[model samples]
Target: MNSAKSPAKKSWLQTLIKNKNERKKVIFIFTISFLLVVAGLIYIPIYKHSLPLDSKIYEGNFKELGSIARIGFFAALAIYPIFLLLKWKPLSHIKKGNFELKPLIQFLAKYVRQWHVPIALISTAMIILHGYMALIKGFQANFTYFSGIITMAVLACLLVMGVKRYKRTDKKWHLKFAISFLVLFMIHATFS
Candidate 1:
C-alpha cells in the first residue's frame, strides 16, 4: 500500500519533464534536435560535397541567417531575467502591502509569461539553423562548435524544464540549468 509517510519519488530528469504537455514538448524537441543534428552530421556533408563548389551558403544568405540566429540567441537570453522576475516575484516593494502597481505588474507578467515559450522555440530554431549551416560547410574540431553544442543542448533542457509543472520545486534546478547554459553560451560565443 502507498503510505503517507513515503517520500515522493523525485527524479532529476523528472523535473525537466513534469507533465504530459511537457512530455510532448520534450518529444518534439528531441525529434527536431535529432533531425537537425543527423542532417548536419550526414545529409549536410553529402549535399554540400555533391553540389558544385559555387553553390554555397557562404556565397549568399548564410551570413544573414547567422546574424538572425545571433540576435535570437541574445533575445532568448534576455528572457531569462525577465522570467525569473515574473516567476519569483522578486520585487519586495510589490509584496509589502503595496497596491500602487499590482495591476501593472500583472499586466507585465502576463506579457512576459506569454513570451517565454515562443522565445525559447524561436531561439532554439535559430541556433539549430546556425549550427546546421556551420556543420554543412565543414564542422571543424574547435571549441566553438563544442561549446555551442553543449549550450544548445542545455538550453533545450532548460526550456523543457520550464514548459510544464512537473515538480513544485524545480525552479532551483531551472535556475541552475539556466546559469550553466548562460556560462556555456558565453564560452561558445567567446570562442566563436
Candidate 2:
C-alpha cells in the first residue's frame, strides 16, 4: 500500500511539473512568498531606524531630482506599451486599410522600437538615483516603500531577461518579466 501511494504521489508531482501553466503558477506563488519573506526581514530593520515623519534630512535638491527621475522612468516605461499598441492587430488592420495612416503608424512603431532599449537603460539609471535619494531620506515602514523594493527587484530581473533576449539566449521570459515589472511599478507608484 505504501509503495503504491508513493508512485501515485510521485506521478502527481510529475504531472504538475509537466504542465506549463501549472509550473508558471507554482513559480509565481513561490516568487511572491519569497519576496514577502524578504520584505518582512528588511522592513523590520528599516522601520526601527526610520526617522520621524516630520524629520527632514538635508534640505538638498533630492526632491527635485526624484521628481525628474520619476518623469524619466515613466517616459521610458511608456515606450514598450505604446509600441505594442502600435503593433496591435486592430491597429495593424487599420494601417493596412488606411493608406494615409500606414506611414505614420509604421514610422511610430519603428521609432519606438529603436528607442526602447536606450530608454529602458536611461530609466534604470533614473530609478537607481531615485531609490538612492529615497534611502538617504529614510526608509519608513510602509506599503509604498515595500512595493518599491519589490518593483526594483522585478526590474532587475527584467533587465537581465532583456539582455538575455537581446543575446538570443532567451525568448519569452523578457516579456513576462517586463509585464511583471510594470504591474509592480504601478503598484509602487500608486501607493506612493
Candidates' lDDT values, in order?
A: 0.63, 0.63
Q: After superposition, which runs of candidate 2 have C-alpha atoms over 4 Å from their true positions?
A: 1-67, 77-99
Model 2, 34-105: lDDT tens digits are 564456446534764563433454223444544565665566566666766766777645634437554676
Rate residue 109 of model 1 by lDDT. Answer: 64
Question: Which lDDT value does model 1 have at 135?
Answer: 63
Best by TM-score: 2
| lDDT tens digits, residue span 35-114, model 1 | 75566557546766665535554535444555665666566556556555656544545644645445565676666544
Position 104, candidate 1: lDDT: 61
Which regions in candidate 1 have their CA more than 4 angstroms from the true location? 1-66, 77-80, 83-105, 164-171
- Provide the TM-score for each candidate, comma-separated: 0.56, 0.58
The residue pairs found clashing in candidate 2 are none
Instruction: Report the Cα lDDT for residue 36, model 1.
Output: 59
